[model samples]
Structures are given as structure tokens and as C-alpha cells.
Target: MDSDMSMHASYAFKHTCWGILLLFLAGGVADCSVVVTVSGPHVAKVGSNVTLNVFITGATRPTIVWAMGDIPVVTWTLGSSSPPDILDPGGVLSIERDGSLSFHNVLLNYSATYTIRVVELGVGSNTSTFTLRVFERPSGDPMCSVTGVNGNQDLQYRCQWAGGTPEAQLSFPVLNATSSGSGDFNLTRKPSQDLNGKEVTCVASHPFLQRNCSVTARGPADFQPLVSSMVDADKKLVITIACASTSLPVATVTWSKGNQILTSGGRYQISSNTTLLFILDFHLNSTELGTYTCNAVNILGNQTNDVSVLGPTVSDLGLFPNQEGTMVTLTWETPRTSVITGFEVQMMGPSLLPSPGGRQRRKRATNEFGTIQEKPSSARSTNISGLDPKATYRFRVIPTAGATRGQPSKELRAGPGGGLSGPAIAGIAAGIPCGILLILIIIALIILCVVWRRKRRQTRYPVSRAVEKVVATQPNLNTPHTLLTGGLKTSAGPPDYSVHLASERSSTLPSVVSPPPVRMATTV
Candidate 1:
């Protein structure tokens, strides 16, 4: 037993000696004098490549060693036969005759605390360490992107990058854009297609990279899709599909209900190709209501719309006419589709075209519950009243489905009052009297002309010879005494003064009288 214990003790001592030797050797390896620094400057960009240059000017190349943190880097020993060099995929280390190291393609991985060691028997060996800091290359500038754009709008471009090897130039002309460093690049282009139907590409030039790279954006194709948002209206599911596609464009349309393979049913009706409208109506009263899935299959791609139906629409439409007013009442069953919680009532006149301004009547009905029309199968009926007399009205019932809430109905015509014949008709019958009055005026004018002609002829007639004889026998004149005073007037007897002075005034003119010497004695 004593021999065994002594042997054990000897073995333990030997192990201790070996451990001590290893510790001393490890410490000697750590003892060295070296210096390391990042090349160019203390700061570098995160993305742009940089080189790490280390200088050991005051020390010999044989005594110096370098490491990245705890990892041992290659060492160059001047006396060794092996080539004094190290190679890292990130960059190659060139050992300069002056004992400096040059590393190219410096990466973020190179960033960290680095230590350099050097030892030459004289002057205690020393280690110099440095920290490599990398800041994120300025969030690689903001880039602009456009998808599914159209001719109505133009493509816009702008760029902003930070932390590049050389600061980016924000003032350069877009037509002659130039980029610096490896970080971010952008382009502004007016992409126009060629007649041969090839995509146009825009190129960006890199000043630092010494090369040009191209980016291609898409433009117009043969088939285009314009899908209308979904809605639940009427008693079924409704969706509108309009295409601005450019080909002879005879497209086959197929609708699907979710993963459940769709089948053509009574409720689906497509408008004539000339009209370009399609409708699917599932007259969902209580029993026939259920959720529906719709898919529009086109050349470009397939669009899917899922809608749920809910109620038994109670629709009431009645017509009434009275002395004063005519009225119509419409009531409908609830809808059986998702998102159709209410209804929109539309009344049209001369068939009111949907507003050209893209407007709907904009009235709505609401449902308090989140109801999914799961196999609804009942009918529902509403009323409209106070319409003008004898007027004709057209009505249509359409179901709302999916996203938008309403659908229009087919047109219906209603005739109110159909009132009595017009009063102006009697006035039209009295026109004969006016014509008779006109004729009477014409006859009166003819009679007046005849009377005027007769009067003019009578005034132009001559008198008889008997009137002339009566005037001749009335008086005679030629006496001188008659020429003075009263005697001058034609008289049968002379004036007294004229009779006394007859002889003296014999030279005066004589007067004449009627009864000249005896018209009565003329019988002799």
C-alpha cells in the first residue's frame, strides 16, 4: 500500500510540471509589439468597400503579429523559409518590406477590435489595438416604384441616399444621371414601347463601379382588366366586369364560387356581346339564400369575389289611381349575400338612365346582424305612393352583392290617372265662326263701292230749259237812275230822288227791273 501511494504522488507532480510549461509558452506567444490602423480615415461607409492598411514603421517584420479580436491572423517571420503572407477571401494581405499589412475589400465583418503584437528581444514587446467602426450605409436612399400604372398619369422619379463612399449628388440632371459608390442608384425615364412590342429599358451609370446596369418596367399589353368592386343587391350576387383590352378581344367569361367548382345555373345571365353586361341573380327569398363565390375568368388572369346572401326580401309593388293622385308601392324580400345588409330603392321615369355623373340614388337600408345568406329561401315585398295622374313609370329590380351595396332592377312601366280629354279641343271646334266673320266683312266692302259710283253720276247730270226761262223773266238792268243808291238795285220803280233829278242825271248808268214795259202786254 505505501508503494502505490508514492507512485500516485509522483504522477500528479509530473502533470503539474507540464501544465506550468504550457502556461509559460502561451504567455510568451502573447508578448509582442505591433500596430494596426484602418486605412484612409477613422470612419468608413457600411456598404462601400474599403481597405484596411496597417503600419509597423518602428518594428521589424519578423517580430510583429496581428489578429482580428481573439482570432489569430497570419505572421511574417523574416528568418523562416515559408513565404511570409496571409490570404482572406474578404481581401488579400500584402506584407510590405517595411512590415505593414494591406487588406482590400474591407467588409462589415472586419469591423471590431483588432490587436497587433511585435517582439524582438530588445525593448519589452507591446500590443496596439484599434476598433473598426462601421455605420450603416445611409439607409440606401429612398427609391420610387410604380406598378400597374396608366396613360392618364406620368411616372415620377426622385432619389435620396446617405453614407456612400463618396456622398451622392442630388443636383445632377436626370437626363445625364451619374452614380457614386456601390450603395444606391436610381433612374428617371419616359418609357415608350416600340412598334415591335418589346419592352423599353432604362439604364443607370455608376461612376465608381465603372459600369452601367439596366432596369426594365412593364407597359401596355394585349389584355387589360378593370374590375369593379363587389356588391350585394336585389336578391342575389352582383358584379360588374369591364375591360379596356386591345385585341379583337372576344374573351370567354367564367364565374366560380370559391374552391367549389362552379356550374351554370338558372340565376346566371350574360348580356349580349354588343351590350357587354353580365348578371347573376339568385332569387333569394328565405329558402333560397346562401353565400356565393364569383370568379371572372379572362385572358389576363382570374379575379375572385366572395359574397354572402342573407334575407327573404319583402317586396311590395301596388298601383292606385284617384281623382287627385296616382301611387305605386314596392316591397322586396331580403337579400342572401355577404355585405348586403340593406337595400336601395330606385324609381325611374321615362326610364331614368343611371346618372351620367356616376351617381346612384344613394339611399340605404341596414341590417343589425352580421348575417350570412346561407341557403335563404323566402320572398319579401314595399310600396311607393303619390304619383302624378296619367303618367307612365318604368321599374326594374336588381340585386346588390359583394362590396358595393346596391344593384338596379329591370324596368317596369306604370300608368297613373290616365286623365280626361284636354279642354283646348273645344276651342279648336269654334274656328268656323271666325271664318264666317271674315266673309261678311268682304260683302260689306263690295256694297260701299257700288253706292259711291251712283252718287258721283247724279252730281254730273244737267238741269232742264224751264229753269233758265224763270231766271230771265225775274229782272232787267240798263237805266242810269238805277246806278245810284237804292235805285241801283234791280227794281220795277225808280227811286224818288232819281225820278226828280231824272233829266239832270241822264248821263248816269240806268238800273233794270223785272216786268220790263209789260211782259204782261207782250200779248200785243
Candidate 2:
């Protein structure tokens, strides 16, 4: 009986110990519902540093595992280092004591979903996940192209940024863009009048690349010059020259006289609008009268215009010999009313006078009748006398003004025998008679034809003429006498009195017999 009681006591004590151990184990397991916290970069650039951390709340120490798509990359234990499970071979990855993964230089191949598992002692495992994306920096510059739009009134520019891991951004004064692969942007605007020669810029911006590009528009292309000279209000000789140019990039205009480039200073003055002008007080040197050039230069090309300063000219000089053969008269007209000093008229004839050096000499006022150098005259005509009767002559005139002498007038050839040679005389004589006879014949034919046409018309449609009859006793006796004319028949009735007599005739009788009405036939 004593042995049985002892055995039963031992069994009950053992059961109580086992029940306590089971309750403790159950409480520990309930405390192990771990809430995991993850913190790290979700995106990283190639060649940049990144860190991913894993933590379990309310746990002093834990075992952690870091993996990429179920493949373990790093593992750690509470009291010692975890087993080596390195996934990156580039020596760029490491793990921290707090269960954090680090990369010194991230690579493109490192991009994947990374999951971290945290386990506390006697606690359950908990997991947190992060997706990492790796990208390379953009490269290269932006390129721009321009084209004309709206009939060249507006310009359309296109800019492109290419060859980047991630696309870059492109921008202009008028537009902007965002792209992931490559960027192409366009802008269009109407250009102002002065917008030629202006610059347009394109800017490209990216995480790792930034650049700018520019271009210049086309410009002016051609030019022309106009030149004139006159005496100014100040009585100073003035010359004005102007240049006009056609260009897109506004042309730069310059002036040059002879071999010297001209600027705005002293006697030279310059001004511009669309037309560029250069004015100078006249200097009568040979160089001053040389060719003046206007040059227009631009990016596209260059153009030039040239003109020479010269004197006034005369025209219409003529000479005619009189019928008496005593003299020849010269006539000329001035082209302009500019200052004229005088005119020099010269004549070379069959009977010529020889000078001392065998060279022709300038004749004085009294030297010879053939050459006449006179003061300016109001009458443009002049007569030359003392010419030998049967000699030929060539006459010309030159106009003089200030210090300039104009070119000689066209030569006029005159001589005896009605101012013509033998052949000219014969032609004139034969032509004049033929012309007059032809005119006379034409007039005679015209008159004869007119008369014949009139006669034919009268015969086709004849008209009647009234006839008057006078009696021998008409002055003493007032009587009515009717005259029958034409081939018409007349019927006389009681005297119809409608005849009117002149007041100058005296009527002795107050009433008299009246004339009868006459009827005429119509002719077709």
C-alpha cells in the first residue's frame, strides 16, 4: 500500500511540470508575430550608391535574408555573420549589422525586385519587398534644323536629343518637351522685319546631359546706285549718291570714291533709310570725278554699283547754208540750264589756215571767221560770214560751264549749192518733184471722184427747184403769175393767196388774184 501511494505522487508531479512548460512555449510563440519595416531606394542610377534595409518591430535581434526574385543575395544572424550568399560579382555589394544591403556602384544588371525576410528568436518569419530600377545618364548634344513656313513669313525649327538611357528634354523660346527615349521638338513663329540676321537657340536638358545649338538666318543679296550733282543753296557744288539693296540678312553698305573709302565726317556726310546716301561738297579734281562705288555686303553674298561724275551736255546742233551762198547759220540747244560760261564753235573748211607748229591753234575773237568763241548769248543761233563760195565745212560746238567743258556736239557738214553734195542734190531734186506731183495727182483724183459721186446721187434722187416769173406790167398792175417747172402736173383751183412780197415794192392795189397751188411728183 505505501509503495503504490509514492508512485502515484511522482507521476502527478511530473505532469504538473510538463503543463507549465507547454504554457510558457505557447506565450513565446504568440509574441513572435513580427511586423517587418523596409526602407531603401526604389530607383537608382548606374554608377551611384544605394542601400536597402530590413527591420522587425519590437525585436532586439533577428535573423535576416535579402534576396532578388527568390535568389538569396545576403543573410545575417543575430550573434554572428550570416552565411556568404553574394549575388553581385563586381565587388559593389555589402551588408550592414542592422540587416541592410548596400551597393557602392550600382549597375544596370542589378535592377530587380529585392525581398527581405526578418525572423526573431522563437518568432515567425516576416517579409518586405522593394522594386529597384537602374538607369544610365543621357549623352550627346541637341541638334536643330530650320525650315521656312507660311511662304517664308514664319520659321519652323525642329530640335532633336538622342542616344540616352532615358530620354532627355528639349526646349526653345516658344516650346518645351519631355521624352523618355529620344526627344524631338518643333516651334514656329512669324518673323519680324528686323528679325533677319537674328539667332535662334535650342536647349536640351537631361539628368546627365545639357546642351545648346544655334543658327543664323540668310540675308541681303543685291544692290543698285544712283548719282547726281548740282549747285546747292549755299552755292557750293554738291554731289549726291545713293544706294538701294535687296537682302534678307540686312546688308552692310559702304561707299568708296576712287581709291578712298568714304565715311561720315568733314565734307563727307552720310545718311540712310532703305536707301543709303553720301553727300559731299564738290572738289573738281580728276580723282573726285572718278568712278564711285557702293558696296553692299551680307552673309549670303555681296553686290556693287558704280557711277562717274561728269559735266552737262548739249544736243541738236545744226547748220544750214542760205540760198545766196553768202554765209552759214548754226543752231544748238542746251540740255540743262546749269551755269554756262560760254560756247566754243569751230569750223574746219577746205581753205584752212596753218599755225606756227603745224598744230591747229585756238582762234581768238578776231582770228578767223570760221571759228567763233563768243560770250553766252540769249539767242542760240549764229551766222558765220567771209566763207569762200565753193568750199566745204565741218562745224561743231562745245559748251563750257564753271571749270568743266562738255563733250563736243555732233558735227554738221555744210557747203555751197543748197548745203548738199552732187548726189544729195540730185536725190533731193528728183524726190521733191515726185512727191509734189504725187500729191497733186492724189488731190485731183479725189476731187474728180467726189464730183462724179455727187452727180450720180443727184441723178438717182433728183430734187426740184422753184422758178420765178416777172411780167412787163408788173410794176403798174398787181397780178399773180405762176410759172410751171419740172415734169410735174399742176391742177389750178380758186386762187390760193399765200405769196409774200418784199416791203420795198409799192403795192398800188390792196387786193389781187392769188397764185394756184402746184403739185410735184416724188422720185425714187
- For all predicted structures, in order, the TM-scores are 0.26, 0.33
Clash count in backbone of candidate 1: 90
List model 1 lDDT by residue over 257-308, tens digit each.
Answer: 4444444445444445421223355333553344444444322234444445
Instruction: Judging by lDDT against the true structure, name the best candidate.
Output: 2
Candidate 1 residue 497 C-alpha distance from true site, Å: 18
Give the alpha-carbon lDDT of every model. 0.44, 0.64
Clash counts for the predictions, in order? 90, 6
Candidate 1's displacement at residue 445, Å, is: 30
Best by TM-score: 2
Q: Which stretches of candidate 2 lie over 4 Å from their true place?
A: 1-33, 69-71, 89-91, 145-156, 173-181, 186-199, 208-524
User: Candidate 2 — which pairs collide?
Assistant: 167-180, 219-248, 219-249, 220-247, 220-248, 220-249
Regions more than 4 Å wrong, model 1: 1-47, 78-82, 85-97, 121-124, 134-484, 489-524
Q: For candidate 2, write residues 62-99 as lDDT tens digits.
A: 66667677566665565574454454547887887777
Q: What lDDT score is found at residue 435 in candidate 1? A: 82
